[model samples]
Target: MKNNILFKQQLFLVLTAIFFTSCLSNVDEEVIIEEPVSEITFNVHVKPIIDNNCTQCHSTAGGTSPNLETYAGVSANAARIKAEVESKRMPIGGTLTDEEIQAISIWVDAGSLNN
Candidate 1:
């Protein structure tokens, strides 16, 4: 009876260890890597930033600031935009991420293409 109890205890310990270890084993982990935007387009990339940050004050109708309402308007002011955003000057009420500033710089450097 003692031998049987010892065997059962050893089996229980081994089974518990196996169960816990199996539970702790690594399942497949999904790591998503986002590739940086190599080509930034005005309509796709710049428009959102301008719409979110500038349009409230600089829309075509308000006219207090330059109209950032269209591609022509934004392209014309791309250099200024880059400068202001780089210096954290333009968003007046808020701020942009470094990545956002870098994207604008990259877009401006790439000729502020309308793509």
Candidate 2:
């Protein structure tokens, strides 16, 4: 019957509206996805790089350049350190990997945090 078909179409429209409304209502307002920032600490990240590559010649005992035994010492020459490392000038006959240099650069840029 025509009436039966009309009723079925109306019911289908109502169901679709209800379905869409429910779906829209279920959406969250603010979805904050906090991405963890990998912090570059002096003792944890920067110290290891200096110890591995720079301390051999930049230490207090038999070092040729400035002392890098402490955070203060390293921070004092942070600019020079960045320049030399970037240019591959220091470490004498050795070399620092791109990752290592980047870590150092990041540390310096982050105010050379002692952590």
Q: Which ten residues in a row have the lowest lDDT in candidate 1?
A: 30-39
- Candidates' TM-scores? 0.65, 0.64
The runs of at least 3 residues in candidate 1 whose Cα sits more than 4 Å from the true structure, single-residue gaps closed, are: 1-38
Q: Residues 1-115, candidate 2: write the lDDT tens digits.
A: 9999999999999999999999999998965332222577788878988888888878877557698988888999998999999999987889888777878888888787778
Give every collision pair in model 2: none
Model 1: residue 52 alpha-carbon error in angstroms: 0.5
Give me the candidate number with maximum lDDT: 1
- Write candidate 1's Cα lDDT for 1-115 as tens digits: 9999999999999999999998878567766443355667777778898899898888857675688888888999999999999999989989998767878888998888888
RMSD of each: 9.2, 10.5
lDDT of 1 at 29: 75
lDDT of each: 0.84, 0.83
TM-score of 2: 0.64
Question: After TM-score superposition, what is the CA distance of residue 69 in candidate 1 from its true location, in Å?
Answer: 0.3
